[model samples]
Target chain A: MVDAGVNMALFAVVAVGYLALTIALGIYGYRKTLRNEDFMVGGRKINPVILALSYGATFLSTAAIIGFGGVSGQLGMGTIWLVALNILVGLIIAFIVFGKRTRRIGKRLNALTFPDFLGRAFNSPFIQVFSAAIILMGMPIYSAAVLLGGVNFVVASLDIDRNVALFGLAIIVTLYVTYGGIIAVMYNDALQGGIMFLGMLILLAVTYIELGGVVEAHQALTNLSPQVPQPLSDAGMRGWTAFPAFGSPLWYTFVTTFLLGVGIGALAQPQLAVRYMTAESGRSLNRALMVGGIFILVVVGTAYTVGPLSNVYFFNTYGETSMQYVGQNADMIIPVFVNEIFGGSLFGELFIVLFLLTLLCAAMSTLSSLLHTMGASAGYDIWRHVRANRSGSHTAEEVLHGHDKDLVRSMRAARIGTMVMIVVTVIVTYYMPANIIARSTAVFMGLTAAALLPAYTHVLFAKEPDTRAAKWSIVAGTVTWLFWGLFIQANNANQIGLRDALFPAATWPGVPYSVIDPLVIGLPVSTVVLLAFFLYGRRKGGL
Target chain B: MLGIDDPWIWTGHLFAIGLTLFCLIYGWLKFNDDGEDDING
Candidate 1:
């Protein structure tokens, strides 16, 4: 086995190499980036393949590999459905269905951000400011989750202090993003996505080999199902291979929160949506579909599939399931598995460093994108619009077609906004509970879906999406979602006043209430509101 | 009730693959029609 000293030396070498390469790319992007538009949208000339991989990398992240992987270790094979959903809805529909329309509209409007697109498309500054506010406010929670996922792995692998690791990671990510903007973020994302793909493939192979093979490992897991902890069995978990019992709490949680929530929610993710605007044309977007789909499959598919299989390995070696073996917090299961499988030998130590690099790739790629989006939303969309509004003579059109000098100021503000987001994310990361990455990711995605999906869908596909309809839809989605999250989901139910005021004895009652997520409630409400408004507007005087 | 024999899962996989193939073919045809003139920029 490689000693600690030697392992540290190897780690330092790989870490420094990765840092140097990413920084060099960032500098290269900075040099090429000319206008504010170029920084925000890569001059609308990003290579489709690069865009595909970058989008996939940013979408999956450590949340999939570590957070959701750990969930699958406990929840079992059903999670593969999520992988299938990610590819189908997240990649295929996203690139093929949404990408083409978004590109045409965004390019025509010269819309620089997702909020900017919405604002311009609907002719509603409210949509712009509100959507940007949602991103700025809600995205920090997701960013915190991503930061926590990356830092937790670092802490577990290197035996480092968690706070120090979090701070250090924030600084590194902030510097790259603030300086290089979207151009640098996407460039680095392509590199990170490559590393993530290779790492997942290797980890998948190593996991299956360690547990014998697929059939053997699965059979072993099935045989051990009776040993499933009482809490899980009570919640209707039959085994990892089988789906949870219909209408059970676990079933509700899995299908509602993890599956439908994230699956449908992905369509409206601001960061991912912005990617659609980056591609040059519908052809570029279409060309990206296959690459993006496969990347999602390779990264997400392997992580989730291997997650359930880890149970077999842990049961044989540690005489417990992967979740139990990792202790109570299931989020650490993937990291712990990495340590145990690849910890002892010299080659194992090398693999550990590579795995760390993979985690960094996943974390940094997503972090940079989310931070960039957050920055642009806050600075470029919200702050600038407010300023322009306050300046009495400036109409929205005049603000939109501002003088060239204003572009430089806006870009500077975006950098400052990026820095601010980093600071907020670090603070939030410090307080986050373990294993919240997947839940947090789902929450953010669902929130985006609720808040923006209906209006966004109408704008893209509708001939003339009614502005009143779009506004109502956003309100309905956000309200219903917030209500459910604050008072219905068991996780957040206890923290809200409604729990104490109405259901002190029973929080989040009913099958739907306890397990059915905001997406189910919020999305339909938003859609109905949109339809009602559209019909009303059409009947009244045409949209 | 579908148990491990759930057909929907398989259906999902096939559908996703189909969608991907469709995109690839459509993109190839569309770009081919857009032609070699503006391919680089």
Candidate 2:
């Protein structure tokens, strides 16, 4: 129905311009870099405004935009509840509860990375090394998921070859991040966040106009019968005015997949944890909270709201269910909606450009942070021990100082690690058999919740968490998630089996249905382990 | 004119209202910082 040619040309020009701007920013950031601190933590002097925007940019990515939005389109407006949670749990509680303490402790210890902080906190090099290893192993899947989003959007919007789009996006992000490091990534994230905010507003306005008014839209939806689209009808696809039926499978997926996966998980993210360390003071972190919260509200709130409304448009025009149009890939729904809504208009072109910029910004910012953490963990934590042991130097000061290098090598190592991660991610993406965004995010966050949440919670609340207990708690949590994820969940016949039920629509025959997600199973296990370890340590005078 | 039967539009309004309310709550919490400054250091 829309003119595809005009849309393609518009999107192409915008994409090219965005790519040029990002490269320029990367080069500019590269020239300004001075030392290890600057390369890794931006010299711990990032302004509150930029820090706030960059945090928001990194937090809400293609995962929030396309993936969650697609789920929202199916789940109705209740998805907005998750958006509210993102601001409250992800942003507010994060800034007030965790950010204040993390910044103070990180500054006290002069720790520039997540692993560095943990290593210093417990005075154990092993914790740092293990934490880094976990991030290196788990984070690539998330990165791959983001990369897939970029490729999918570009291919869909511009009608380009998927392979070309994938390669082009990956190369652009890698080059900028490798060159500029965190500084480039942060500044670009601010710009990308601004674009995302504006683009979503325009898209929302246009969508409203297309649907006539709010009242008419609701009545139209309500009038439709469940038999019209049986899955949607059952999935709580009432007139968009009503919430989904209580405890519907769609409702469960909406809550677990979008809400809990992102909302509660944001608190445990290592990438965001490092941001708390970037600010000059707790006050700076406080200032960032407001800016960050508003940005997330606009960006994430709009995506989730607009995603479901798209179903209405799709169903009406094509006489097909929105899910049918979405096919197996839930990530494609938003792009399809964009093309449907603005395919030929100038707004459409701008939307595509901004959207691609959003993806690039999200990928680069998150990747750069993850790489910096990986490098710090590897260089300062693991490699330091290896080098010290080999040279027979066991002194604590020497062990710490041996790994300390000039900023250039550290930066280069981070970039190299990033490249390695990218290759692995690309391979995973190419061979990925399921919904990369939802599944990968769920896995990563669930792992974090299981492994780090208990320790993190104790660190925040308890005056003195027994060191023995803390160490064992981390081990217990990490292993529990890994056991459920790899052994129990992975090997289950229902999910990821020969026929391949990716999400396990039903519980495994023998496994308790309560053990649905690793987070559900692992959280309680980690808590019990931590408590048991703590009590035993107290009895033994080991606290 | 399309009658008041289109659910997506109403949902959009609901979203707008809900988000606005959320923003207000967030603003209040962020701005009204009670004097509980326990420095971890």
Candidate 3:
């Protein structure tokens, strides 16, 4: 496909340049960081462009590209609706409807982290610790999912050994994140976001050209409609271009898990929400809304669009669907497409370098944000809170600023917690099965929405969300998500071990299992609990 | 146009891209015109 010597030389040069720039940014951020505020939220002065880029880059990782992109390739064009919803709901609603008050109150409350903000907003340390606990428990699985995408690409496209690539990426990201904290993450994310944007645009152009143009490509896809496997066609797949029949499993999977779960679920993401606290004023958020929207449209839209279109290109070139070409594992579709699509072309070697670097940038940018959030939760939210309690500090403000020791000790603890979580994430990556990246990502996102969204929305928009309701909402969300995931979602139920021995409950018997995701069940149940508690609190004059 | 035959494909893609541009332009104009100095202060 390519000349090994020339390609490796170009790749080496590009990789070195990319690494040098990322590390240099880490050093730059480290120098600029001084106080706890600077380390956690960049002293609340990040410009709009950087904040928007960083947020988008973190939001759309290799999981969106390789995992969901692969899912789009497997499932068809229905996933594009997720892109529409991402911009409209994920960015527009997130930045405009939620961002203004979040920044305003976050600043007024001096909230440095998401957990800190939750604790301060409702005046409850339990909320802070509990939210941190959820992040610490759930985020590593999501991070591992992101790592699988990057490592899979490295192994498949770059011809690197899987173990070496996995550990190597983990080590590099850990160093920079531990050194520079959130500031370093944001700086590197902005650069990575740029690469991802250009890379996706070039890839999309090349894909359309390779397919002999869009009309012919789609026509060819229509021609290949009968080639859809019997089970898929039976399950309601009409073709690559058309949506599945209503009330089908494919429809449920696409609508419930991918669309609703990732789209609506994005609002409650801790890492994404923390971005609101990093800006100087509401103006930064206002400016970011547009920048972030476009970035999402490009990065996420390219991934989902290119994913299904890969089927057209693959069938044209190899007489097989992308899924058939890559065995049963959909994760290999995008990497295989990149490897084969550019083969023997004049610029094949150059696109390969850009594509590989772009995937690395996407994965690292996201991993850094997740790990930073986890570290903050563990060190500041849990450790500092417990220490402050033991030392006779009752309020969150006291714990946040009671003694000089708070800042110094918590910073050290944060770095240590990050290192530990890095090791955990790498180990988890080894055990995660193929084709699980997108599903695992959806699980985390759905859990966040179920557990945090109702309470979080209440805190930002109204004054009625108090300590009691907040606690009940978190419990309701987490419990329902876990219960539905274990007893209902087929994939998750199988993992809980000895369902016969544990609960003696059969897997939910229906299309798309009992429910598509926890968001549907957990969200409604949590909302009901939230309102009930809010009313009870009002009656008792607790609000 | 790339001659994409499906109206849905092009229409959806164009709508998404158009909405993104609208957001960027609107945000830029609002930021510059809204007395950002006062907001920051």
Candidate 4:
């Protein structure tokens, strides 16, 4: 075993260095920020390259590195297909199909944030406020999930208390985001992303070296057992070279959870959407695609591959289930494996530093973006109503001036709101439920896809969106997802009850042989509502 | 078990590591140019 004292010292130096870099970036970003637009959208002058890296960095996060990587370890190397989908659907399709139009419309509308963009596009303050509220409520869970990633690594490497780690992370993240805002976030994202790329490369190299070779690793893994688990024992469990058998649960989870959820959901992501408005023009947006694609392929692709292959290493060393080595909590697998690999070697201390840096950057970049989005959305969408209500008390010129001040105040509120969000996330991290990343991402994107995807798709491709239909579609999708997430799916199986329970099985009826995720039910319902509304509007000469 | 043996697989991994490092360096240069433009602009 490695000396705990050396590990602690290495972890502290890395943590302090990361904190100092973030604070310096934040101070710089704050000084450069001269207006609300500059703070919120990086003055809409962000070059394609930084925008691309920031987007990929935010998108990858701890969710991609630790959560998905852990899942890949158990699910086998077939998960690489999801990485391909992330590049294709998440990056390419998002940029080419959705990004160009989003930038054009956003520029035309002078939209500074995602909710602001939506509100202007739809010509509805209600949509803006509604979307902003959704972000404020939903973002904490996602933030907490990211916090868990860093906290887990800290506990594994330095043996620090999880609560202490959580508090330290929350404070550092809040300080940078609260001061520097989006520019600091993006600048730091590019640097952290570079480190992440290098860290994964080192991990892949060492794992391959220790395992002897690719062929030997495969033969050892395959010959060991076919009876270990439902998914891992299958022929597909070897490495990144093969796909799982058709119709298997592993395949479904890959497609639904990682591929479809993250892949398609990236287009509608409020944080990423705001990036389009940050760039100068369509060309900058296009310029970003190559750099973004390669970064995603390297950082995400490496993490996913290392995740499953770690299984082979752990199994060989411990002579027991890899699960026994890392426990049922999949997030711990990567940290545990890293510690084991570099335990007593000179490389051990370096690995510890790199691992903590990777997680801290992952947490900071994702949290800053989420907080900024929340602040901007709340200020423009939610607070606008309060300003409008008090308008009757003021004269015409006074009202106009009040509106300007309200915009400023809303920006201030966003900063405060981010701090509030960080505290809530830290508290929640103390009492987290199981499958933190998968469940949280599922709920978040499921809600987003259900509520926003239908309307967003219409805005992008539909010739004429029936406003009435769009509103109803969003409402139906949003309500349906919320109902299932809160009521139908019990916190535990023992908590299942009548209205929440689906007859003939635990899931809602008519979605037989399925758990009836809201995306399954709400997405279809939203599409039907939108089409019906469009048809009705045309019939009434409203289109 | 489908027993398979090949010495080249070890070499393949070494090749992959080399290729990964090469790509990293290439990407760093390309991204660095763009980043400089962003900072200047």
TM per model?
Answer: 0.89, 0.83, 0.89, 0.82
Q: Which stretches in model 2 have alpha-carbon errors above 4 Å?
A: A1-12, A19-51, A182-187, A222-252, A390-392, A395-413, A487-515, B1-36
Give the alpha carbon lDDT tens digit for every residue of A282-347 in model 1. Answer: 556655665776777778778777777888887887678877776667678777777778888988
> Tens digits of per-residue lDDT for model 3 on A190-241?
7777777878888888887888876777667667778888898987787777
- For candidate 2 chain A, which ten residues in a row score worst on lDDT? A506-515
DockQ of each: 0.21, 0.18, 0.33, 0.07
> What interface RMSD do all candidates show, one decimal each?
5.7, 5.7, 4.0, 8.7
The TM-score of predicted model 1 comes to 0.89
Task: Supply the DockQ value of model 1.
Answer: 0.21
Write model 4 residue lDDT over A1-543, tens digit each, in one string: 222323666666777877788668766655666554545356356665666666566668887777777776666555565666676667666765677677777787778888777666677666776777777777777777888887877777776777787787777777767554444556777667767777777878888789887667666665555525645535234333344545554455455656566656666788888876665555555556657767777787787777767767877777654555676777777766777777777676776677677667777777777877776666556665656667655442232233566677777877776677777878877788545675576667667777888788777666665667778888888887677655544432223344444454544422222333556667788888888987888988953
User: What are the candidates' C-alpha RMSDs?
Assistant: 4.4, 5.1, 4.0, 6.4
User: Which 10 successive residues of model 1 chain A have the least lDDT summed?
Assistant: A1-10
- TM-scores, chain B, all models: 0.64, 0.65, 0.63, 0.55
